[model samples]
Target: MSQHTFLTLDEVASNLKVTRQTVSKYIQAKELNAVKINKSYRITIKDFENFVNSNSTSQEPSISYLRKTKNCTLQYSDKSDDFEVVHGIFHGELRSLSNNGKLTPNKFIFGDNYFVMKKLLETHRGKVDLIYIDPPFGTGQDFNSIDEHPAYSDKLVDGEFLEFIRKRLFLIRELMSDSGSIYLHIDKKIGHYVKIVMDEVFGYQNFINDITRIKCNPKNFARNAYGNYSDMILYYAKHRDNQIWNDIRESMSEEKRKELFPKNHSKLGYYTTNPIHAPGKTLNGDTGLEWKGLKPPKGRHWRYSREVLDELDEQGLIEWSGNGNPRKIVLAKEHKGFKIQDVWEFKDKGLSYVEYPTQKNHDMLERIIRNSSHYNSIVLDCFAGSGSTLRVADKLGRQWIGIDNSTHSLNVIQKSFKEDNINFELLEYVPLD
Candidate 1:
């Protein structure tokens, strides 16, 4: 007998060319044998083989058929099939260019991202923890540095651009771990179509947030529309609800603190108060009885147990009004950070203030990396323009991989990395011509 191995829902889904939810439905319907393990489902190889063999039929729906049956899909010219794209052969190899003389998992690949990422799939398949790509925004314009040096081009637009991104997205999906995530920063003009493309690749259910990033100050351009001071980031998870989420929060602003915590105590600093009594009544508990010669209010119970309330009052953590109403005092110093929302404001600087054109804000990249990846996880940026994502990932103590083909981008990244003393191996994609 052969030793049995178990596969996760994502693994099964990938092999079956379907969504994880589809595989879950099979498990729920008892069509596929699966066992619960650590709050997740696992299918033995034998059982999975048995299910596929037993379910095999002459009229089984094809992957293209399945694609069409999706509740929603982006239909465009030259759209490749998922199977063809995932298994497509790109005739290229990653040739090592330089070794930093130290053992490092970090790499900087100089090549077209599409081919480089395909080569990466050989070793890094389903291993990347986080991906952040600021690809071309399909503006059909060339970008330049402050010195008028040509940086990159974004001439592909319409269906050509969509297909280009869609093809790479399939490769990106293959490179992501089951708990991985991707954040694609793009201009708002083409971001909507890319959203549909993401939906097709990552599945709509896995779509996380369309983060509206305020990238610049409001511009008073003479146009027929509002000032386009913001771009969008399409955030998606490889598997919904299973991606790495540190739930990092933002600290309260000083003005916001002053507004919320209006009262100030010379001894205790800023503070606020909340009603001590809650809505429900505690009929048979000590909370129903009076502690300081006061009966329980009508249909209300003490927020805390009577003993706890007594302790709070003794500790001067309670405020009593002139009419004898008691409230709990909350100090500003003890405040937890506020939850981060979908909208973000991390403005980018001018071309003169940056080494590379369209260099992103460091703080924004930091927030994404800190929230979505661990210290030991591999963070990848295929369209690594200025290598800002790689720098931030390195700063956060994460392993990073960057891929770009532009000479200017490589020059900027090399100089910047050398200044920061970041060591990494460099490789180039070589065609077997």
Candidate 2:
């Protein structure tokens, strides 16, 4: 209940530019005061200051909070330095592929997304508000459309795949606004590793959710494992607690309504009864007082004040049992929809029903855009498979950008956009040499 006033050994070590072992030595030697709480030593700020002041020499600068808090990072064979990844050069240029006859913020880049994203950092850094990308799943296979057209390749595997994603994530983090968020759709096989990579780019505290998306129906494979029917979407914010979150809810279905609001009322339609008291006791409030000669149950407090409870009883909103137990009537119409959870069932259609291979569900994209962005926000999809994210963002009145290296993806996006009467510019990444 109190503000956090203690620091962990790791935090102290990071701030002092030393190791946890060194901080432990200071504690063991009784130089720094610390308390043992739940098997871990927690040093208070006052004591830490005392230790620092007592140890620092006149010639040395006083130490402040100089280092970042320790965080988890994925280690792979070819992982590059974060600084190098952020400053890496891409010898490519964005050239206009087509004009939409009007000035618009929406654009599609038909080129390698890595290079395209690097180019974007020059002007669009910290401008994009939301991003949703569904990259290849590293299955070591080639993807093709329903008509046998080559779509994209997923040749990178293991450490190579991880490094590839890590490099792009560094660039993506730079392109994100302070309040921006990104949702990465990935298969469960490699999603965990990618999550750690994201934690390295975006701090671990910025992670919002690991959404389990039911991508398809149960598979009848003859493997010694459970059916693979789902994938995961890793969601993270550029800065924790700052990204736009609309808290969109899912509408209740007729089946759920019948199940929850089973009782029918003549005037209030379908309704249900709820306990008038909540779990915690209120010792010095009106909720703790008696109402209608009845007090709240033991260890509980009235959900409403006694005056409000009296008003509800007078309005016939409180139902009384034969034994004098009372419950407030809840109308189904007054109930808001169910809160959307991490597990979603927006299944993708068959290959023949989609324009591109591995095209995601439109409803899923709609949910992501509606919840993570606003009308004026800029939505970007670097691995813009079938351009579903861009289309959804456009439909939701948000500006959008799409980037992909696959010509098949480009053609599919162009066709879909034209059919939808969406006006936007197109560009291509041309190599310099």
What is the C-alpha local distance difference test score of candidate 2? Answer: 0.85
For model 2, name the residue pairs that clash: none
Stretches of candidate 1 off by over 4 Å are: 1-71, 321-324
TM-score of each: 0.84, 0.79
RMSD of every prediction = 8.1, 9.2
lDDT of each: 0.87, 0.85
- Best by lDDT, which number? 1
* Collision pairs in model 1: none
Clashes of 2: 0
TM-score, cand. 1: 0.84
lDDT tens digits, residue span 1-433, model 1 = 2212655575578557677789999999999999886567878766877787787785543334223324355666786655566767878899988866877899999999988988898999999999999999899999999999999999999899999998899899999998999999999899998998887777666789999999999999897998999999999999888899999989989999989999998888999999888788898998888878777689988888889998999999999999988889999999988999999999999999999999999999999999999998999999998999999999999999999989999999888898888989999999885
